[model samples]
Structures are given as C-alpha cells and as structure tokens.
Target: MRPQLHLTAPQNWMNDPNGLIYYQGMYHIFYQHFPYTCEWGTMHWGHAVSRDLIHYEHLPIALYPSKYYDRNGCFSGSAIEYQGKMYLYYTAIRYAKENPEYIHVQYSDDDLIASQAVVISEDGYHFDNRDCKHLVVDVIKDQNLGDVRHTRDPKVWIGHDGYIYMVVGSKVSNGCGYDGEVLFYKSEDGVHFTYQNRFIDSSIGDMWECPDILTIDKQDYMIFSPENIDVAPRPNSNAVIMPVAFDEKTCSLTKLDTYMYLDYGLDFYAPQTFVDEYKNRVMFGWLRMRKPVEGENWCGMLTMPRVLTQKGGHIYQQVHPHIQKLFNQKTNTIDFDEPFLMRISMLENEDVFLGGLHLYIQDDCLWCNREAISIHEDKVCNLTHTPPLNQRYDLEIYYDGQVFEIFINDGYYVLSQIVYKIIKEQTKIKNIELYKLSKIQ
Candidate 1:
C-alpha cells in the first residue's frame, strides 16, 4: 500500500526530488518521474503543491524531454524566485555519439552523458521548453573542471551580494581513485554564469549527487548524497551534512567539522530544503532504493516534511508542526489495525532494551514476538542504538498503512520502510500515547 501522509506519484517510478520552493502562499515540489512505466526510463519533472506540508495536490508535469538540450531526460536541480518570477536550474541530459576523452580514461567507449540547462516560468505552474535557446550553461570543455560527462545536478541560489551562485556535481581523478567534486559558478544575472571555485574534493565519496546549501543562524551547511562509500548499518547512497564556513571575500567554503549522515536508514536520499512561508528551513527527501513490493503498481515516496534546527553544533530534525495538526484524537491503548501516531519514552532510571525483540516470517505468518517492536511483513528495518541507563529515550512513530516512519529522540536518528507482508496478529507497545490521524481530504 502507498503511504497516506507521504508524497508519491500516482503511478510509475519516481526518484530524486528537485526544485523545492515556496511562492504565492503555496509550497511547490518537483521530482524525477517516469510516467510511462513503473521502471526507470525517460525522466520528467513531476509537480505538486500544498498549502500545508501534510496534504498535497498533484499538478501537471512541469518539464519534459521536449528540447535537444534536455531530450535525454530532465534530471535533478533547484528553484528560485527572482523579481516575482520562478526560475528552475536543472540538469538537462543529452547523449552524444562519441564518448568524451575523460570518460575513456575510467570507463569504456559506451559511457557518455551531459547535462546543463535552465528554464523559466512567468507563473509557477507552467515552464517554457519550446526551444533550446533558453540554455544558460553549455558542456564544459575545460579538462581541469573534472569529467564533463559526469557533471549534473545544478543547485542555484542568490547570495547576499545579490549575485546568483550555482554548484554542480562532477568527478575528478586523483591518479589512484576518482573523487567527487562540486564546481561553483557565479552570475551577475540569474541566467549567465561564470566559473568560480570547486569544493569538497577527494575528501568524501567518489561521486556526489544532488548538492545543496542551507544557511541557519549565519552558519552554512552543505548537503549532498555521495556514491560508493561504505557506511555501515545504512545504505552506501546516503546523504551527508557538513558544517561549513563560507568566506564571502574569497567565495569559498571551509569545512568546520567532519560530515555525518543525514538519516541512518535504508530509504532516504537526495534531500532538498527551502525556506517556507513561516521562515523555517523545511526539508524533504526521496525515499529511494528500497525493496520493491510484491504486487504494488507504484514506487518511491517522499519523507515527511521536517523542520531543521541547529543546536550546540548539531543539526536536529523534527516533523513540521503542520503535520502534527492532523492528529485529531488521542488514546492510551494501541490500535494495531489503523493509521496512528505513537510516541514512546522510557521511564526515569530505566533502560529500554530492544535486543530481545524478534520479527520474522515463520509458517508464512507475520509475527512480532517482542512487546517493544512492531512488524508487518518482510520489512523489519530498525535503528540500532544503545539507551543510557538512567536517561530517557524518546521515539515518535507515524504509522500510515504499510509505511512506518520512526523518529528517535526527536530525529537524531530515523528509520523508515514500506512493509509488504501481511500482518497475522496484533501487536502492542507500552508507555506510548496513541493518536488516530484524520485522513486527508
């Protein structure tokens, strides 16, 4: 079953989220969608909007593979509002007959893909892609800028100096291994861009995708999803958050501390953030690379909108307050059959043990043998963390149909998955307040 509160395409495959913004009293989100089939194919920009982040209304496709600049696909990117108009900077893909020289060094003669383009809209709902003349950036011929074939995913924003800045993900070779790099560009006008600087070279993963920057309390934070990195207890394609200090004088970023995973789970990736109408940093992530359901026709879902805050040098995430307003009634007893909100906490001087819980398939029955754990079917994804002896551990769970989103200690850790197997018995949890969520109209 599809998620009730989360955003997903009505049909077909969806992947990385792109172009998140708020304009004209509505929150708009765009994503990589293949509408023709359930499998990954030609990508298009699937659009949606919501007054409140909890309930969404799907709109028409914003961008498609119509022009030569983006004939291959419309990949990931970001959006900005300029002079009451909406501008979308996206990775427009086009295949070439001959492979680039850089691709021949590391890959065979078969791998060659390039993307760089921008589209504008007078109204936020419609975009212009009739001609390829709207192209702002072209294929890079500079060898020092890294592999041009691998350069994509443009993230653009306006700096305090009123100059527009863009960051694009690319790959650079370091004699022994290929390292991920993000090339920077600056434009006096939002369309024409000039090369600035490159950052996060060879220190992170081999390839970075969907790069973004968020500023909170005058502190800069860089976010991106890296590939080919070994991250235990989580997927290798994980999003990372690094605290960075931006030097306006030099137009560069200095790493202030080490990077950490944004979510310690299997389903989160390609997260993007935007300032909402309430002036809060709201973030949404694509729930990708998960096990497919047996008979489901649709795939991919977005994580619940989370408000980000930095406290004591750590970034904290919590469910947006607009979502909490959907909880209409509260009760003390658990209802295992319906969609609900659950909050669990440990008592004083007590440790909540989770090791004894066992969820498995036996005799074709979906069984959850432990009181603290809940199970529906084959998906038994859970976060592994030790609780302090005398400290309290809080867990907030949103159960909507077969989807379960677990937020531990106010989102210091999060676990989410879609359970496909059927539930054979009832399960209960203690020290939890159960609230029945009113279904969205």
Candidate 2:
C-alpha cells in the first residue's frame, strides 16, 4: 500500500538516507537507492527536495558508481554547505580486481575496499560527480586505523574551533575479531582531511555505520547503527543514541551516558540528522522492508522528520511542525479509511486494540504488539516498545493505513512500524482530538 504521509522512493529499492541538509531555501534528501529492481543491488544516490518539508519532488540521481575508486557503489553520507557550495561526502566502494563476479547481496571480507570522497554542487539541484569528485580519505593506506573493507559513512561538520571535522564509521582489530569505532579527521579546508584520532568503545558491537554527531541543549550525542550487538529484547542491528563528550581541540569524542535505541521498532535504521531552517536538529530514517508490499515496486519509506530535544540526558524526538500542520482538520473517531492523527491519554494497565495492532500499558512500559498482522515466519513482528512510562501518559499517533508513528508523552519515546492492514479497531478514547490528515499532493 502507498503511504499517505511518509516519503518513499519514486520506485525500486532505497536504504539509508544520505546527504540530508537544508540548502538554498530547500530541504534536500539524498538516499541510497538501487533503481533497476525492488531488491538491493549496486547503490546510487537518489535525490528529492521540498520547500516546506511536507511535500517533496523527486530529482535526478545525485551520485552513482562512476570513477574507479567508487565503481562498486556510492554509499551513505552527510551534506554540508561550504563557501557558497554544497559539499556532499560519501563512502566510495571499490571491490578487489579479482572479484569481478562479486554480488552485492553476498557478503565476503575479501571482496571490497572502502574509502571516502566528496562531490560539490554549485546549485542544490545540480551535481557533477565525474569531474568534480575528489578523494578525501583512502583506506588502503590507512589500514592501521580502520579495517579496509569496513571504513565508511562519513559525517562532516564545522567545529566550534573553526576546523572542519569528520567522523567516519570504522573498525579496528581487537586480535580475535574487529570492534566498531569512529575515526576523526581534521581539515583546514572542507576537502583536504587528515586523520586525527579514533574513538573506540567495547559496547559498540562489531561494526558501526552512519555515524552522526549533534548537540541538543548544549549536550553532545552520537547517533549510529551497529551490527552483531544484541539490545535487550531484540537480537539484530539497530539504531542507537548515546550522550557523549566532544573535545574540540583534539577532535575526539568520549562517552558520557549509556546508549538507548532510537526507535523501538523493527523497521528503522541508518538515521541521519540536519540543522533545519528553524535551527532545530531534524532527523529522518529508512523504514526498512524485506520486500515490496506484494505488488508495489518500491520497498522502503522514510520516517517523518523528527525535531530532537534533550531533557535529563535523554534525547526525545517530536514530529516536525510542518507535519503537525498537515493534520489540522479535526475529526471524532480513529479510522484507517484514510490517514489520520489522534491524541489521547491512558492510565496504567489500559489496553487499546486498533484492529490487528495491540497497544497496552503494563509493567511501567507502553507496548505495541503487532503480531496479529503481517506475520513473518523467521522474525517476530510484535517487538515494539517505549521507555518506561509514568502512571499516566499522553500519546500522539499518526496512522497512514499501513504504517504508524507513535509518540509517547510528547515524544519522550517513539515507536514506528508497519502493519499490513487493520480490519477492525477496539477501545474508544473519550474527549480526544482526532483529525483527518491532509493527503500529500
């Protein structure tokens, strides 16, 4: 089913969001895409833009596999504006020469070498990846600092000390296997970069991807994706948010607080954030899917842009104000006949069933169980939760037929997931404000 309020690719496969930024009065989102099929393949950067962050227009591909250094794929990265130009930095993949038969769906340690590069666009809509692309970091020569095949996903920004700083997801040898870490790079200019130091933590899993650093309420935090780590109640790769201490002079990061799952749902990963026009750190993430929904050619969707805030050392994600404006028309009941939004309050032990999805409050936690719909034989689909809740809490739910984005207690906790269909709903919320969301044109 086509989503009513979320951003999906024009067609085919899309994964991690790349090069998210607000530039020249427009919000540009570049994503990792494989255009020819509904399944993942050789990666290319697909482009889209919106003036108000609610409605988007698709553009031509921004970056692809062209040069020898990046012939295999153009992977995930971030965007920044420098000197009247937009600088898009991404990981460039080049497999070994003997691996001519390499398939992207298969994983092999000996199959690839990864590096970093940047492409500059004078105008936000136009990109010249062939002639303008420059190699900024080479993994082949810096193998001591990171694993040659795993170093990627460069997130760059200017520091308070007036130096261009970068954090790239990397892996360093721990004798038996590799441990995830982040490599810091210092640059006088945005293009030329030198490796300064690396940040390593034992809890950071086997490898990390899509590393992002942002300050909220004067506190720094790192957002990233890690593989092979088991978060409680879930046993796969997931997005993580952790409070950190960044040293501007040394260009390094130190962990300050424990990490938490960014979204407590199955279909979220590789999120990246950008400073919006309003100066809020807004984020978007790939709502991952195993396949196209039966007949559709597109297989992925993006979460509604979330404005992040911090309180008591924990990050909270609220729906962007532009999204709030779309649901201005008020209604009376919650229905899936079309997209809708609802705000309600529930006390402890209260349970509500919206067709196949089950929401309940128990054990001081708000839980969303969706096993009754869209069952997968290999994986359990009912594993969604929020952080511990108070005796009473408010919820804001945006239901777009097949997908749901739930914000708890004004986004102190968020849970986003996809369910195929809800045939019926139970439990009526009294004195609640339910609104019919405006359809995207």
Candidate 3:
C-alpha cells in the first residue's frame, strides 16, 4: 500500500515526531502518536515514509510503550545512518512509580521495511535495553541537567570541525525560569557522546520539544518547536523556526536576526531534515494540529516535505518546487484592481480598515505580530494596501479543505486559521480587491 495518513486516531495526545532517518532510497519517519483521543496519553512512534517526500504512506505503529522502560510512552528522538546500518535514539517514558525519562537506542541491519522492530539494541546492537536503554554520560550530569520530567527528542549532526555532535532538548539547572535549550555534546563514535555547550538557549517558551540541526553550504541552522500556548482568541499549536548560526570563536550557537513561521497553516511541526539522493537539503514538517477540528477523527498528518535555501544569511523554505505539479487544479486568471469585496459583499463591509494596511515591501520581508500569535487564536488581520509588487496575489483556496491560511505579498506574511465545517463553495467571500500594488520582488 502507498500508505496514506487519515485523521488523528481517536486521542488526547501527540506533539513531536522524533526519529527521521532516510535509508536505501526510502525515507522512514517516526512521530509521537497517541491512539486514544484529542488530549495526549499513551504515546507510541507512528511510522510513515515516501521516496519523493511528496506523497506519503503511513505504516502501522512502529515503537510501542510495551517494554518496561517505555511503559508509559515513547517520546521524541532522532535517527542516523552510520557505518552502513540504521540507528534510532529516542526518549522512553513512565508515569508515577518511576516517572524519570531516559534515552532508548535501537538499530537494524538485514531486512528493512519494518513497522516495529523487536530487535532493539543492547549497546545499540540488535538487543533491547542491553544495559538500561540509555547511554548516560556520568561526567556531564553535573552540568545541572535539571527536571525529572526531562529527556525527549535527541538530534544528532556532524559539525564542520570534523566531529559528530548531538543536541538534546533539555531544561536548565534547578528549572529556574522557563528555560529550555538544545544541550550540545560531541562524540567520535555516534553512540557514546561527550558534553559540549548550551548550544543555544532562549529561555522563552514553556518547554522545548524537538531540536534538529541542518547545515547548508557551510551555514548551520537549528530548528525547534515550543510548548508555549499564547494565541489570541484561543490557543492551538505553536510552531516556530528561528535562524541559528554557529560561532566558531566560542564554539556556541547564536540566533539570527529574524524569525519565520514553520507552517503558516494549522497542524504543522516537529520538523526533521535529510539530504536526499540528489543531496538537496530537504525537511519534513509534521502537520498534526494540537486540537483537531470538532468532528474530525484523525488529529495528525505531515506536510509535503520542502527544500531549504539561504540567501544573505536568511533561511527560506519553499515547498519542494517539484510538488507544484500537485496543485492538480488549473489556475484561473482574475483581476480586481482598486478596493473590492471578498465574501463580504456590501460596500462598507468590503472596505479595508484604512491605515491598518501593511506592506511586505520586499520579496523577502518577514514581520511578526507577537500580538497576533497565540496557540488557538482566531485572528483576522485586515490589510488596506497591496504589496509593492503590482501583481495580484494568486491564492489557492483549499476551502473544501476547511483549513484556512492566507499567504499575502508572495507568501511574505502567512495568516492561517481554522474555519468550522461550513459550505466550502459558499464562502460568502467573493471579490478580492487590491488596494495597492508594488513592483518590488
């Protein structure tokens, strides 16, 4: 079967996807999935893959919490292809009796296409929990790796310094403020790692879940999603992507100037990357909304993977251009220069909120309305001016796909919202007027 993803299985949980490994022409993606209902409970690793990362097929559950170490739930982690074999390192959990979390390592050699491999690892070799399901670094423990609630999502990457490094999502000493950072460590061998630095810490969001690093043409990029829920109107999923540069001088990481949306639409996060057969840096953003629409059974899905590019130190992600063919519907050319009404027909209603209009002056202008961002917020931003580019913004309205996202000024500012089940065609939105336009690219 060319595996397909359905709505979130009846459940209360599912946040991050951990192990993303590409092998022998096949990309294996495992995520945190809960079989129960909309709220988050017993977690398992949901599996899926694709050759092109465009069309995906979902396989059965991959790693269950059936073992003692992972009896509670299996959390986030990452995958690496080292020494001709595939290895997975993830966080396994427990509730009360022994709630402390730890890392679990597993590997595979012979037959590949597996839903769940019982042949885990002992020293990461074909046996489950050979020691304690975790490879702990004793000397590094004093770094004050606080919180018994710690441990989940380990991201490994090879650095420019000719050594492999891994960053785990961890809290700071004493759990003082809301500080979550990507703890760095170095290792000659992919298995036993040595502590490095704080990598990068914003101390901003509630808890940092998945931390994955990507380097393109010599520049390093760190990607992560926070558990912060401060949306206007209501709260939903909070997925953010920031630019991080590694400072060779201090051997640390620094945040770049701007921040962009991971996925402007709903249900998106836990992104992981890999250089495909063509060696192009590609990423997969899981499209699993924290809160599914009212009656929708499934709560999770993954977006078509995208390619990453950097210009002038800024990183931009575009749906791998090849998938443009997936639009499937032929586009219609329409024009509505000057102010006009969309859905809201009446003259007064169609009117732009005057000076409220904002312009994405350049082809790559990115601005954020912190006030406009919160978990489950119903936000409506009105713009009175068109972009500097005189071209009308051609939009693809996936209405029947009740999900609503607005990409204005050539996708400069993405505005996405959740619209309840209503008549798709009768969106009431008809004329889309252009108040102004610019020639800027």
Candidate 4:
C-alpha cells in the first residue's frame, strides 16, 4: 500500500518511470529501481500496472543486466510501439571496463509483437527479455558530444514523419554532477541510431534528467526536472515546461517560449506525459526528489496523475477527478471570491502573516503592529490599511494546500510553497471566516 502523502515503491529506491504505455486495457509503468537498497545501486526496470492510476498492481522486475556491459544494471529509457511491436530503447547501466568511466546500452529480447494486433498484450500482461541485455543504442564518441558514459534517461517517440526519434539525458563536462543535455538522435529503423544534436543545455540550473516533449492544443511542450541543490520540500530549481517547434526535416528543437514549472509544490519532478486514447494529455512523475519517510521500508513517490490543459497558452495541471474515488478524504469549500477580515487578541502585541497564507492586499497597504508574533489566543487579520501610495502588490500566502494560497495582489503572486511537508491542514481563520470552508483539518 502507498504511504499517505509521500509516495513509496513496494520494494526499493525508484527514480523515474520508463516504458510507460497502455496495452490492451492496462497501463504499465517501469522505473529505475534498486530493489536491494534504500539508496542507489545496480539498476533494473521495475514493473507495475493499473486499470486506473490509483490502484497499481505490482509485477515481476521487467529487465535485468545479466550480461557484461549491462551486468551493472538497466538504467532508464522509454518504450514505444513501433511497426506493430513494443520496443523499449533504454540505457544500459554499466561503467567503463578499462577506466570505469563509460556507459553503454542493454537490450531485452521480449519485445512488443505486432502480429498479435495488440498494443502491448491483447491476450494479457506478459513480456520477456528476448534480447536479454543485448546492446541496442550504443554511445559512439563524436566531436560535439562528451563522455557518453554519463548518459541515461531515454525518451522515444514516433516523429510526425512516421520515423522514430529519441532524446537521451546525459551529463556534460563529463561526470560533473548537475550539468547535462537531452541529446537527440533518429533511426529510420528503430534499431540503428545516429546522434543528431543536443536539444537543451545542462546549465538550466538543475540536473538535466528525464526529458520529454509533448504537444497539446496546437502547442508543443518540453518537460524536464532540475536536479539542483535546493531539492525537496523546496524548489528543486523549477520543473520546466518549455515550448518547442520540432522541424521534422532538421530534427532540431526550436526553443519556443519561456520555461514554466508544472506545479508550485516541492515534491514533484522527473515527469513523463502521454495523450490517452480519449486524447486527454495526462501526466505522472516521480514525487519527492529525495528518500521516503522512514520505517515504511520504501523511498521516493509518484505524483497524483493529472490531465494537462492549456489556458491563455500556459499549461495548467489539475488532479484528475477520478482519483477522488481512491482517496478517502475530500476538500471542503472556501470562498476565494469574497473578502474576509479578522482581529485576534494581541497576546504578544505583534502580527505575522505567513507567505503560505494568501491574503489579498490589492492596491492597498497593510500595517501590522509587528512583522511576527507567537501567541495563540486572539488575533487580527484585518484588511483595513491601504498602501500610502495606493499601489497594490500580489497577496502574501504561506501555503500547504489545505491552507489558503492568500492571493497577494489580484493573484499576481501567492506566497505559497509545495516543497516541504506541513503536519496539519489549515482550519478556519481565527479572526476571520469568509465563504464556505469544507476542508478537514
């Protein structure tokens, strides 16, 4: 069972999910799993399936590195339906034999077969490593490219031209921790591939990992998570959703608009998305970049699945409505439209408003007796003072979902965060109560 709040795998440390596809009527998710430890170790593809995202059924480990190059592990990659078969193109988790600095590919003999006229397995969920760690995509050294030994995280797709293309994640400047690129390549036949170009730079402030490009509602999107220093319960740099226009002939990404984060939460990253049979652009990603809450015997988590929708060109992700069927709790209502003010007794003679609590001061100035206070009895959340200059800024909000995202000035900025975990859900305002509030505390 998944622990509440933080997501945990059934067995071990899981980084990112690969080979995600729906076959017959089931959804499959594979990830970089090290079953032996709570930490990083030899990589293997872990498997699970769900008719719905909420109820996941675990399966046997999908691919293992039983061969020489891949003996270390099967790192990360993607699964695609090609020529009527399901083919997984991923990185083989191996190090340099001579210098211990190189990386390679691992293959699986159990591929997607088209003759059956099924997506993955029309008969049922069954796959075998037929290739059995055979090298499929190799790291051939080229001038523009650096040490391929640091490459992994392969994303494959059928290009608009009906050919196959893959974008692999790699660390540049050699093995330097956080800098990498989503290296691009193409294959007339899904087997043989040649390097085309580096689509994105590694300097975008986060470890360049799990690069996926998606197009929804007549626009293109490039998805990636930053492995920056300030990870977890805080921004891990911001997960990027940049716009792109892929030139089918050139096979190069023309960077579109500015990059935006998928959510304001700290626990989300390494996301991969797909359009469902119904054409809804749904996405799921590894939740919480760090280890799990102790004693549960598992670490890492996956975010609640959400459908991607665009409004005024910005992609907005909302938790899928259906997940509520699995969830035991529900959010009550709060009036975001009406204004509410309060006055708590000044036990300490000073007032502190959290960036987490969103309070609109639209074009108005608020003066607190003090910037902070530490008493519980009585308080004041009055919206009385207007700015001397009559200028309004975004509302200041100290948020943890259940708490208000106090819209500062007209929703321009709500001082709220999703990176850290809060022990309690917010309750009724002591000094104020506006519209209906249904959320349980």
Q: Which candidate should be chosen as best, given lDDT against the real structure?
A: 2
Tens digits of per-residue lDDT for model 2, 1-441: 688668889999999999999988989999999998988887999999998888789999999888998988998899989888999999999777544464554355666689899999899788897799999998655556788888899999988777889999887778888789999898988889988888998677889989998899999899999887665446478899999998878877899878888888757899999999999999999888777777687888889899999888778899899888889888776667788888878778887767677788888888888877755644434666776786657889888857888888888878887876575754445657788977666
Candidate 2 has which clashing residue pairs, if any? 355-424
Give the C-alpha miss distance for residue 438 in model 2, angstroms: 3.9
lDDT of 2: 0.84
Q: Per-residue CA lDDT of candidate 4, range 134-197, in tens?
A: 4546654552464345566678888888778877665455344446466777778777677777
Q: Give the TM-score of candidate 4.
A: 0.68
Q: What does candidate 2 score on TM?
A: 0.94
lDDT of 3 at 86: 57
Q: What is the lDDT of residue 37 in candidate 3?
A: 67
10 residues in a row with least lDDT, candidate 3 = 108-117
Q: Of the candidates shown, which would achieve the greatest TM-score relative to the real structure?
A: 2
Give me the runs in candidate 3 sitting further than 4 Å from their true place.
1-14, 36-38, 98-143, 160-162, 173-176, 200-203, 229-237, 247-251, 264-267, 288-296, 328-413, 416-420, 428-441
RMSD values for the candidates in order, in angstroms, are 5.8, 2.1, 9.9, 10.1
Candidate 1 lDDT, 162-243, residue by residue in tens: 8898988887778887898888888887889888888856778888888887898778999988886655533566788899
**Lowest summed lDDT window (length 10), candidate 2:** 97-106
Deviation (Å) of 294 in candidate 3: 5.5
Looking at model 4, residue 14 earns an lDDT score of 83
Give each model a TM-score: 0.86, 0.94, 0.68, 0.68
